[model samples]
Target: MRLVRAGRRAFTGNADVLADDDHRAQVTDYFADLVRPFGAGPVTDLSGQSYGEMAKALVAEVVPAAEPVDLLVLAFSIHDVWPGRATATYLSHVCPGTPMSFAVCDQGSASPFTGLRVIGDYGVRRALLVVVEQGALPYESAAATPLAHRGVAMLYEEGAGTRATEVRQYPDVVPEAVPELARRGVAELSTGHPGARVVLSDSLAAVWPDHPDHTRVPAGQPMTGVWWHLAGASEDAVLVGDYDRDLRYLCFAVVAADQSSVD
Candidate 1:
């Protein structure tokens, strides 16, 4: 298993705060503690721009020469709602009139979100997106951008990609809300792959404890999804999301194992 913790910037408990050295240092320290158990070599110090860029850099630097692993733990957060793709975080965007946005990265100026896969062989090979918690209001897409959930609706509406995946959402903010994001993430996981196993996680293991480590925490269930690509789809493993914080701060387990085994 390979664990990687990356952050584009730091909030420093101050939403009004600006991005600067302190924020960078804070991000570094935060990721340092996060990646400690996993290994320093695999951890990347990305404190500016989108995590996708960091992902691009990390894969080129780390994954290429490293050994193969069963799973890759991705812990990334603080990306603008505005859409764009990258190595670390996935991108999606929407315009005001659109029914939904789309997950796009590779086709930055183009139409396809193909650019999302950055890692050489590790691109979409049985990956997982931690479904990290998002702020009440982070940012919005431009009027010129096509907007919606992962921007899938726009493409389907426009007949962009012939293939499409299904996702169902619940109403409640905690269990329902997080699951919505997880479902969307899982849909992204199933793209291009024939069959896949979705891995679940424990909410008790979330990045944040039951109580608030920060001043305010979102009220929701932890969001997580484990995707086994076409290669291991036959295993037919289902993984539930588990974490220390209940839907507050979520991340996938970097090490590969049945995360549901413990409390």
Candidate 2:
């Protein structure tokens, strides 16, 4: 059965959000510009906080609506990273995918997990994340979906090891491309709505990773997922900010066969 493609944008890892400077506007303004094009459908904007509360509101706003596709993006500050699980839950339950895109703000003084490493055996292959720092954000999804932060994503690893930076902890969810989840646990619907394929990516660059000088990764390895890149299918582009250290966040762009070059 074809399902809708869900994506997300979060400010959980944005160091700028937590900055004491009066640039809080960056957090608010960026969000506004990002979501301006994407009319509300199945997206969660973690601008301020109370994501739990936000979830409840989203349910009320978009429930029993045919599982609409979900797209997330955020330029976070401080309240998001410490409890990375919040964003994880939002992504895991709300939007399904491994190595999900993540844009975190790290100023070398603060960490998303607040002194704890979010290295919970989870791999980026499960979901590709992209972190952009001091760089402007894109304004479109690779799938051509109307979203904030368009264009390509740059990869980097900044502040690999430092006393000021702290590692963080994440949820214990199995983030990989499984054929059918093999009934191992509950099967999450990648798309909140109905669609032939679903692609989730960030429209812009929103994270400043712990290691920003790392070499850029070309693309992400393929995993199990819905056929988001089918031929003759109306490309449903759901765009937002992808905030992970890996540049695979934009992998959602081209996964289908070359239409003109194929049978």
Candidate 3:
């Protein structure tokens, strides 16, 4: 299937608070202007509402009204799913009237891509994919990384926009095999678009080395990679997201349009 339109909403974060002057350079290799933060401050509290509520509302707003959605697939990180927030209830609230609805959870950053495959396997012609993540609590000093509330929506249909050629997940990857695995993954996708770029997820960013057309932007959330590809980056690119080193599962999405039409 292909994406028709996409939108992203990031709450309460700015690009001015990098830990060091060299952080940006180390991130993208392009001398990025600013690093976007997803943690505390005025920007994070834009709607003066709860992250989950605002995120669901944003999904309702960003999804194209003109499109006919047959399926609603909601993706969330472990941080978003909590006690009392039943998935079925939220689905009804955010995507009422859809004939079918489902959720992808526990995959961390790989859930969104899994959602895409779900649509394809179910033969749904039109679908809505939503992913949301919230920042770690202010007092949670044990948090691995500063979290931010973020959400993204994408409208997908059978035959329009940028097509996703291949979406595959690998299991039990060894550290010794990452370089070769990454190289082979990129090489396979590059066959069609020789100039395609690489967008590495947060999991693989530190270990993956830079290459021509390589752009590293840590996915604050699972589906954030799709958001970045749709909102920024080259139209033809490869997205690599690894869920866990121990679980060793890696997900890759190769996006490209008709090569003849691509410039």
**lDDT winner among the candidates?**
3
TM-score to native of every candidate shown = 0.24, 0.21, 0.70
Question: Cα deviation of 193 in candidate 1 (Å)?
Answer: 13
- Number of backbone collisions per candidate: 39, 65, 3
Candidate 2 residue lDDT tens string, 1-263: 11112222222333433453444444445555655778522123332233333332333332234333232222233232123245534533553332243334442212222211222123221121211111122222233211121111111112222121112222221223221221111112223322313332111112322211212222221110111122223443211112233222212121222123221
Across 17-80, the per-residue lDDT of candidate 3 in tens digits comes to: 2333463233332212122243322222111114346456666665545555788787775433
Query: What is residue 148's positional error in candidate 1, in angstroms?
Result: 29
For candidate 3, the per-residue lDDT at 156 reads 62
Name the weakest run of 10 consecutive residues (lDDT summed) in model 3: 40-49
Q: Which stretches of candidate 1 lie over 4 Å from their true place?
A: 1-50, 57-76, 79-164, 173-198, 204-263
Of the two candidates 2 and 3, the one with more favorable lDDT, higher being better, is 3
Cα lDDT of candidate 2 equals: 0.26
Better of 2 and 3 by TM-score: 3
* Superposed model 3: Cα runs more than 4 Å off: 13-52, 96-99, 137-141, 160-163, 210-212, 219-226, 234-243, 257-263
Single out the weakest 10-residue window by summed lDDT for candidate 2: 220-229
Each model's lDDT comes to 0.27, 0.26, 0.57
- The residue pairs in collision within model 3 are 12-43, 12-44, 109-222
